[model samples]
Target chain A: MKRALTKRIVIDGVLTAMALAIWVVEAQIPLPLPVPGIKLGLANVVTLFAMFALGPLDAGVILLVRIGLGSVFGGGLTAFLFSLAGGALCYLLCLLLRLVVKDKQIWVLGALGAIAHNAAQIGVAIALTRTTGLVVYLPVLVAAGVITGTLTGLAAQASYLALKRTTLLSRLKGGASLPKEPDDVAGEEDETEKKNQK
Target chain B: MKTWVWVVIVAVILAVSLTVGVVLLTRQPQGNVAYVYVDGELVYQVDLSKVDQPYLYTVNTPYGTNVLEIAKDSIRIADADCPHKECVEQGRLKGSPLVCLPHRLVVKIAEDDADSVSR
Candidate 1:
């Protein structure tokens, strides 16, 4: 049991590191639209994956660490506020999404989470700038959010599916015996995911 | 019901937003008063139609400074100390706020009555 606990900590730490790297790299890319607060949100793929594969707590940790470190590395206090508000909004919605959809439909989680993130960001921008004219950008921002969210969601789904094939996940259950076949793992997921929803 | 179905619904919503955004972007802006804001406080307001000659106004903040070029019927960021210079590249503001996230600066156009409501 102790070994399993250690392994989970190690995995969460690694996921946090991975998320930070992705966030910093994505910030370097020049956006085509020249729009503020719009990006592919590639780092969210890791957060979404961790949310589904590990649990909400692990996902929240990874997200907080990434945003806290990301802003220090790439932005200032104002940018940090925006990221915090957006990330918190996204995570809250993702948690509620667990009840509405099955594991196979992570795309829904991604799209909805992205939309929520953008909405919160817009609210922050408007508040910080004291200009209601920023609302003019909402439609395009929402459009971008949906497209990027769906893309990242699909990527997270692929990673989740691929990870399930390995015995690494089974180690979480007190390092139990590995499932011998792919079918065995798939069948096991059907049961655990249902329990996870509640 | 299926994953693809969810994707379709999101796509449709995206399409509607895109259409609306494009329309808004292309529409002509009617406001003559341009307001510049920093960290949620109104700093400057100019009537574009009243400017007889083009001028540069520099706004200094703890984050950075942005030089705004004001002219008849239009205003833009002539220069900025922010890293990306996105505000400068934004060219001119017609309707949407020219936002500089790095410097926490925003310049936008609004009607006369809009000013009282926001303040």
Candidate 2:
């Protein structure tokens, strides 16, 4: 049981590392919306996956690690604070949204999360800049958030479906040393699957 | 087929979008940037319609002289010491922000007396 759990942790670590790498690489690209706090929200995919796979606590760990690591790799200390503020806000919102929302509707959660994140960062920027004049760009940032979050939600959903299909998925879902399901493997998982049953 | 493909596609889309953004940003009308000066202290109260004639505000930054003009809106330095002159080229900032990276100065349209969306 412990060995299986170890292997699962290793896999989660690897996936988290991959997500961090993507965050780093994406940062190199210039932002399209010059309105201040807008972004493509590329790395939110990993957070979505982790949220679903490992639950909110584990997801938080993944999120903080990814942000800390990604920020160091991409932006410096001050820069990290900006993105971190945004990412943390997004993470919290996504977690809350996950409970009330499900299935494809998760896209809406992602969209809202992105918008919230952007809003928080803009607030920070306004305070730091000592200039409250950039408020005009909020509309554009919200619009961008809805778009990018939808895309990321779709991407994460696809990956989650694929991962859930794997045997390793059920094992991880069982949690470390949690009770293992017996005789379910030969019978195409439980009837809990809403999409696959169709 | 691969996750990296999604990343690459997003990156490409972002690159194209940013390129388009630069072009569009350049085309935006250069309005006036009002750095409100009250009682010899630099303030944030520059009005375009209120001002009768074209007025120029000279600002010294790391990028040398940043000349902002107030007509109907706002416009900035025609010539700059900075290589990227993006802020200068940003023109007027009545309804937006003129971000000059070279000088770490951002001139944005204040929404206090404005009739636009709220912050």
Candidate 3:
């Protein structure tokens, strides 16, 4: 049991490091859109993957760490607040959506989570700037969210599927035995394992 | 739910938002008055139509500095000290306001009303 606990902590640490790296790199790449509160949100791919593969608790820990550290390394207090709100909202939505969304439908979580993230960021922006006129950016932000969210979602879904086929994920999950087949039964077994972990 | 249902729903949302966003982007402002606010407080106002020659306007807030290029009937953020410089890249003011989120700076064009009060 202690070994399982240690392994879980190690895996969470690795995932958090991966997420922070992705976020810092993504920040370096300037987006073409001049609109504020819009980006590719590639780190979301890691969050989604962690949530679906390792369950909500691990995912939440990874997300919070990434957001907290990402802000500290780059943006200051205001950026920290914005990311906190957005990241919290996105995590909550994904947690709720996971029950209804199947393995292949992880992209739905990505798209919806992205929308929630952008909307929450805009809310923060409105309150900070005290400018209701900022609502004018909603439609554009939503459009950008949908496009970027789906892209990241698809990436996560592909990663999840590819990794599930190998023993890598099982090893990460503290050497818990995972079914090797890539079929509906294998998916069901994974779900049962997740339920047991919960 | 079927995968197709999710696809259709996302597609519809994308289409609607894109169309509305485009319309808003393409629409022209009805007035020549620009109001600049820092942390929700009105700091400056400019009558763009009255300016014959372009000039530079600078605003310094607790967050950073933003340099605006005010021209005849148009205003744009020429530069800013913010990390992304998104406000500067936003170019000219149209129907939408130029927002520098990090600095809490907002520049918006107001409607032309002969007797409108500025609060």
Candidate 4:
């Protein structure tokens, strides 16, 4: 039992590092548009994968660590607040989505998550600035969010499918021995079989 | 559900937002007053309709300084020390506000006395 706990921590730590790296690197790239709070949001791919494969709780830990560390590394207090609001909204949306979305439709979750994240960030921006004029950016932000969210969501779905069959994940599941069978993410081999038959 | 269903939903959302964005971006600003803000504090309010001559105003913030060009009917960032130059590129204010995130500077158009007066 102790071993499993240790393994889970190590994995979550590794994933958080991965997310932070992506966040920092992506920040360095010049945005194509002039809009603030708009980006590819590549770090969210890891968040979505962790949420789906490991669990929401695991994903939450990784997300919090990533946002906290990310702000220290590449942002300030204001940026941290924006990220926290955005990340929390995205995480909560994912938890709600898990109940309805099928494994094959993970991309939908990604798109919606992106939109929700952007909306929450904009809310923070409005509150901090105390300006209703910033609300004018909403339409553009919403459009951008849908596009970027779809990309990240598809990326997460692809990663989830690829990692599902890896011996590492199997070991994480059966070896660490969580007796894992959530109604949301069970029957992996069966899913593969169904895919193959189709 | 079919993957197409998700695609359709996203498509509809994208279409709607895009239309709204275009409308907002292209619409003319209705009011005469333009408010300048730095770090969320109101610094200056210019009544564009009242200005007979074009002028340049400089806003100095801890983050950086931005030069704004104010004209009879329009306001724009003429120059900025920020890296991206996005504020400068944003051109004149139409319906949307001009924002320089790095410098925490914003220029917004107000339509009525009440709008700028409330702050």
lDDT (C-alpha) at residue B38 in model 3 = 98
Which regions of candidate 3 deviate over 4 angstroms? Answer: A174-198, B114-119
Write the residue-wise lDDT of candidate 1 on B1-119 in tens digits. Answer: 67678768888989999999877876666778898888877889999989999999999877889999999998999999876676787788865678987677888777666434643
lDDT of 2 by residue, A1-198 (tens): 676666556646755686787677766665644565455777777777768866777677777888888766745553577678888899888877787665545555566777778777776666555556555555556657767876777777766676676764666666454435444532333232223212
DockQ of each: 0.56, 0.10, 0.70, 0.47
Give lDDT for model 3.
0.84
Which stretch of 10 consecutive residues in model 4 chain B shows the poorest summed lDDT?
B110-119
Candidate 2 wrongly placed segments (more than 4 Å): A1-5, A175-198, B1-33, B36-94, B100-104, B109-119
Candidate with the greatest lDDT versus the true structure: 3
Kindly report the TM-score of the first chain in candidate 1. 0.84
Summarize candidate 3's per-residue lDDT along A1-198 as a digit string, tens digits. 675676678668877887898888877776666577566688898899899778898999999999999998998887788889988999999999999988889999889899889888889999999999887778887888898899889888887887788666776565454335435534554554333222
List runs of model 1 lying over 4 Å from the truth.
A172-198, B112-119
Q: Estimate each model's TM-score.
A: 0.85, 0.65, 0.89, 0.82
Per-residue lDDT tens digits for candidate 3, residues B28-101, read 88888999999999999999999999999999988999999999998999999998888887889888889899
Provide the lDDT at B1 for model 2. Answer: 28
User: For candidate 2, what is the lDDT?
Assistant: 0.61
**lDDT of model 1 at residue A49?**
84
Cα lDDT, all candidates: 0.79, 0.61, 0.84, 0.80
How many backbone clashes can be found in candidate 4?
0
lDDT (tens digit, per residue) of candidate 4 on A49-132: 888878899999999999999888966776788789989998999899888888878888888898899888888777766676
lDDT of 3 at A53: 78
Local lDDT at B64 for model 2: 50
Q: Local error of candidate 1 at A174, Å?
A: 4.6
